[model samples]
Target: MPICVYWGEDDFAIEKAVALLRDRVLDPMWTSFNYTSFPPEQADAAIQGLNQVMTPTFGAGGRLVWLINNTLCQHCPDNVLAELLRTLPIIPENSFLLLTSRNKPDERLKSTKLLKQFATEFREFPLIPPWKTELLVQSVNQAALAADVKLTSKTAQLLAESVGNDTRLLYNEIEKLRLYAEGSNKPLDVATVTQLVRNTTQNSLQLAAAIRTGDTAKALGTLADLINASEPGLRIIATLIGQFRTWLWVKIMIESGERNQQAIASAADIGNPKRIYFLQQEIKFLSVEQLISCLPLLLELEISLKQGASEITILQTKVIELCQICRGS
Candidate 1:
């Protein structure tokens, strides 16, 4: 019950969780003496952490040994695993061992299995994909509830669209809205969220939509807005690749005579089977060939961005090409 494992792509959420755990486990007066952290760069951090967690508390509080950005879950050397096997069961009840990582622990790994058996808690803070609007809206609502801010359903949806999958921005915006709602009797409305939250509606998803519709002008415009907003070019390409890949999968499944929405959803990695209906409608005008063609262009765009080409120029050129492909021109 003294071992905890937290791994995920949502770094801000992980950091907040860690802070809460630190507060719960360590006495403020004795924190400096009792809390030991091994950053990823520290040599033999996992083994060192295992050793540290076995030590008795220094003062009046429980000891907490943290292995930050740990890779043991992904690949633990036999020696480290041996140490964990020896130390974990005997760790003092007054001491806690915490391992955190950005990568998911491989369930097949012996180290991960051992940690699962001993860990009191194992949690993942995965980032929601941008295309998953329903999940994003739900996350926004939950965050608003936590921040003690009231928001209309429309306002929650608006905030979700504005912030997308950025948990840090979502929390900061919710905090700002909470402060503004001090003594206000009404729930925050869409107008209020639109006024306060940075309007990032012109995101990569919007760019993808513009391309789907063969609107070269709109696609170019959205690309400009994203670049102007300082959105990373590689991130933009990544989103495009994911979006296009999903579309391609859906198209392939439908064209292959797969009628079951759940099957199509599963094939495309879509969470909601109902969403397949909407996606089918969106891509009805395009053939599988067109969707297939977008992938190479997207790959080229990604390569150009990585090679230090001008972001705006390369993005704009690729956007035009994608629009043409969708347009059958």
Candidate 2:
């Protein structure tokens, strides 16, 4: 693949793809002379990488010029885009240009148009939707296999639920599990997952669910678990604020007759449309006014924490207050 494009939202997958390309293209002995990686944010990265990729290899094998997070087809300045369009078509067979982006390229751009000619070499690694549990489990199993660890199907499912769809975090958790099970022949099980994985984000979601349902005790318990686990005070507040804000947005949109799940998910930035069903159920008992009021109160809690108030006290007080408000007391 002379002009390889590995664009994706999943940084881990993008990185693995890039590394594989490097191994396939560049000779290890001549890597210093053959491999160049350009971060698109750097000054003149587009022109520099294009010029570099066209330069022939010094000694033996193929050369690779990687533009990680390249935005040439979308945000590159005019000069750089012009230079890229001029240079891309003439790239040597032995010299490869590898472009990766966090987003899909703008199809209308000339650079994107030219690249479409080589669509077979273009790869995309979008994040798995929230409802794709099977894909997530497969990902974890693959990571474990690479690390020479055995992750059972049931355990992988449990782990995927805890980690959600963050590939970087999933890989990190798999490595941790690998080390944990190094000497034992037994595979990683749900019991070990319960003991080791922090799953702070999921806990925060559970906190939101507890609050939405007016279960003060459960809310307090989840919050306490989070606090005891050394989760940051501001992070907890931020999560609650985000959840409540999402609820408010979805509620208002529903009232406005936005019945499409995809539209609701996109509007609320929810990764999984299926969660909208659960969100609908959770907020069924609460009013729009209640959801609307959450952010300001959470902001106050945040300020109190920053001003040296005990986190436990502020968090517990806010949880109780919200629970009361949610119960219409």
Candidate 3:
């Protein structure tokens, strides 16, 4: 029950969870003496952390040794693995060892299997993909509850759309809303969210939507907004590629006479089968050929961006071409 493993792309969530765990397990008065942390850059961090956790507590409270950005689960050297094998099972009852990484642990690795066998708490904090609206809405609702802020269902949806998969932004916005609602009796409404939350409505996902609808002007404008907001060009292209690829899969499946929603969802890698209905409607007007052609252009754009091309100029040109393709011109 003293060994914990937390891994995922959701850095903010993981940090928050670690802080909570530290507070819950370590006594506040003796925190300075009881806590130790190993940064990823440190040499032999995993081995050092193992040694630290196996040591007895100093004074008043239990000990906590954190291995931040640990990669042992991904690639454990033999010596480190040996240390873990020796130290983990015999860790002191008054001490806790916590390992955190942004990468998912490879289940096939001996280190990962060992952690699975011994870790009392193993959790993943994956970031929800921007295309998944329902999950984002649920995330907003849960954050609101934790912040003691009440929001109408519509307001939660609006916040989700506004923030997308940015957990830190979502939490900050919810806290801001909570402060604004401190004296009010009613739950925050859509209008209040619109008034307070900075309109990040212009994002990569909106760019994809504009391209799908063949709105060159809208696409270009959204791209400008994103660039102005300092969104990285490669990140934008990545999102576009993922979105178009999903559309292509859905289109291909439906055209192949696949009627099972679950089957299409699975093939498309969509988490919820219910979303298959909406995706079908969204791509109903587009042909498989058009969807198929988009991948090359997206790949080309990614290449150009990585090759030191001007981001704004290249993005603008490709966005127009994509819009034209979607329009069947």
TM-score of each: 0.89, 0.67, 0.91
What ranges in model 2 sit over 4 Å off? 127-135, 145-148, 152-154, 182-185, 198-202, 217-329
CA lDDT, every model vs. true structure: 0.90, 0.80, 0.91
Question: Candidate 2 at residue 247, lDDT?
Answer: 89
Worst 10 residues of 2 by lDDT: 128-137
Runs in model 1 lying further than 4 Å from the true structure = 252-266, 303-310
CA RMSD of all predictions = 2.4, 5.9, 2.2
Steric clashes per prediction: 0, 0, 0
Q: Which ten residues in a row have the lowest lDDT in candidate 3?
A: 198-207
lDDT of 1 by residue, 228-322 (tens): 88888987888889899999999999999999999998998888799899899999999999999999999999999899998888888889999
Q: Which pairs of residues collide in model 1?
A: none
Q: Per-residue lDDT of 1-329 in model 2, one digit per residue for the tens?
A: 37887777788888888888899988889999999988857888878988998898988889999887878667666787678678877888889888888988888887787777753488889876444455667777888889887877788878887776678888888888888988988887778887887672455667877888788998999898878867678767866787788888889888888999999988988777887887787688788898877778888998998899998988999999888778782
| Candidate number that wins on TM-score, 1 or 3 | 3
On a 0 to 1 TM-score scale, where does candidate 3 land against the true structure? 0.91
